[model samples]
Target: MKLHGTVPVMLLPFRADESIDEAPFRKQVDFAIEAGAVAVCAPGFATEFYKLSDPERYWVAKTLVEQTARRVPAFVSTGCGSAHATIEFSQYAESMGADGLMVVAPKWCALGVKELTAFYEAVCRSVKIPVMLQDADFTGAGLPAKLFVELAERCPNFRFAKLEVLLPGSKCAEIIHLSGGKLQVLYGLGGVAMMDGLAHGATGMIPGSALVEVYAKIFRLYGAGQVDQARALFHRLLPYLVFALQHLELAVGIEKRVLYRRGVFPSDRLREPTLHLDNDYQKQMDELVDAVIGLVNEVKAATATRG
Candidate 1:
């Protein structure tokens, strides 16, 4: 119920023709569970939600929820450009049995505090499930900790947040303290600041799914009081994390390639107009993964041994 630990933001698999590859997508969900993710999320930024047609979006969310089947909690990003569409999507996700909903603020145009609150409030009111506000980086909108506290007070179901701020550690700490520990915050931004998020106050993470086991290990290590070990492992993976997150759009291609190489997905295909990682970058990515993969394996071994 707390939704702590790694709830990977899933990547959608596509066939060469650009159709949703259902089989691999399902496999990817199982892969996350096998790797020890606490929950699974879809229709998020990493899922290429904007690129998906309404049917594609619905199918992906419905399939993910059905496949997850309450094995772990599943949350869907139901944010749309308007409150009406957001409510519709949120309700549909709930109908598909999503345990919770994550709504990023409406974008392309800024909303006044009152309008933004109303948008989130409308979505929150439409669902019986818990709602998490996604503080996205796409918009340059700066959400103060007070806004979250105010939303939590207004909507009883507004209990969780996915923070993607510049200074997430200090901001997370501030939100927790200001909210009297009522709001649970999860670190977004592909888990780049995961250790900082955890050390500061993040109860969980919603990172790209290419390496759930790695993040899971970090979370486990931290929780088990192995701060030094956790920090070391995090540093070990820092290179790969840095490269993959360098260009946000390009990061999607990089992650799909990682999953492809890992055999989690059949192919690393993205919709058109995507940033292509040149051969040089691809080689660097290969080397980065090679360097950090052992650390991942070692962390997995450590976790198994600890158990």
Candidate 2:
């Protein structure tokens, strides 16, 4: 399956004790597919993959693949601290029937181009499935576009790039231009830069799952030549996105809360060492979720009618 359109980076639902909440997690998978997600991804930054142990990571991957059940493509994030661990996770995801893998460069220590290239080459070569390089530079300095072109030329499975920089439009255009047509770009950062990224030739976006229906509608409108409609719809979502993306931990908390409000998740519990939304923040989030709930419902009802 081709990795394109709105693929949500899933939020792992947890119980009060921080154990994985299996039932609601399954509901989330079904919800994404029902809401028109082209694919589903998990254990990314938003999923709090850092907090998960190795066994928990594998379990999340396996459960996601199983819940998705090939209804649509499922992509798993397999970026680990070392190349060896990353390859191991990538192969495990592939073995569990994931359609693609999204790999983030190990962020514990910065690696030069040579080291980064070698790391990616090894992982891509180890898996037959398509690998998406996540250039997630939250600090505003992103990987050079030429590195992506170089990796594409070297590794057959290195086919996609996910741009999560401060402003990703130019980088998205540059990577596409440099690679000629070999690489497909997917914008992240909770789809905050989605319209700009789409205008710059991004194939899709990997946004948080709470509002997958709304995002999917925007993508379809853009693809159908309804640029004005798409822009207008995306503008309605801009405020909430800007608010949630202020901090990664804050974003995870907000997404899980929205999912809970929408009745997809039973609880909006984040693991310890996480940011807690104060009373003021909670009120603001509730207002934001209220502002868009109707729009989300309208989109879903329309989709169901069309189907």
Candidate 3:
């Protein structure tokens, strides 16, 4: 089946000290469903997949699927930095009842396209569930759009791709041109490019900002056919989007902190080695949040003025 519709790249919840907060995690899933995500993803790049242990990963997937209760599709990130681990995660995830799998290119190895294809092929063949590709920077993961077209043709289970082609140009155009009305493209980076990405054929977006009411409206407005409204909202959220994208070190913390502050979860805890923001970053992050709120207020005022 083709990847279609709006799906939120769900974030995992954690307690104050950074342990898995299962109760709030499950609640976040329910909130996402309530907010109208047709499908949900677990422990992907946004969910801090790398920090999760095998057992913890399975626990989160099982919890999310259970909470979703077959209400919609549930996808879990199965790609570890290792192919062997990825195969294992895929098997465990499916056995635990995930609706599908989101596999990323091996980051630590910095695999080339060939290695990426081999890794995906191995994981897909090992599982009965459908799998999609998530391409990004250090993973050496961005496959040419043509290669994906071929993969979509060759791999029966290759259902979708989260194209994080950060740069704009021919490759982005190529993905749009070659999607062939087949694989559903998700706009991986969450910002102004979102509207353009959809115009280019990305049916969905894996944005953590979806957890935020205003940001989600930016996406929902577009999906609901209010193009100008959506563009207006996108610009409003652009500052936060840039903050999240620019501060690579603190991106995960930013999402977690924002969600925690919004009461989406119990705490903004990240697992060990993925520490929380420092006082300086936290101070800046606080200002960023203020700026986002200011922007939202400005948009609300502008919208009223337009009315």
TM-score of each: 0.96, 0.97, 0.85
In candidate 3, what are the lDDT values of residues 1-307, reduced to their tens digit?
4445557777777666677777777778877776556688887777777777778777877887788888888888877778898898888889888899988777665456676777778888888888888866533336777667777677878877777765633455576568666666676764336777756656676766334445455666777899898887677667677778864436777777766766677676676676566788778888877766566456556656866
Model 2: lowest-lDDT 10 consecutive positions: 1-10
Candidate closer to the true structure by lDDT (higher is better), 1 or 3:
1
lDDT of 1 at 68: 96
Ranking by TM-score: 2, 1, 3
RMSD of each: 1.5, 1.3, 3.6
Query: Which candidate, 2 or 3, has the higher TM-score?
Result: 2
The per-model lDDT (C-alpha) reads: 0.86, 0.90, 0.71
**What's model 2's lDDT at 271?**
90
What range of 10 consecutive residues in model 3 has the weakest lDDT sum? 209-218
- Decide which is better by TM-score, 1 or 2: 2
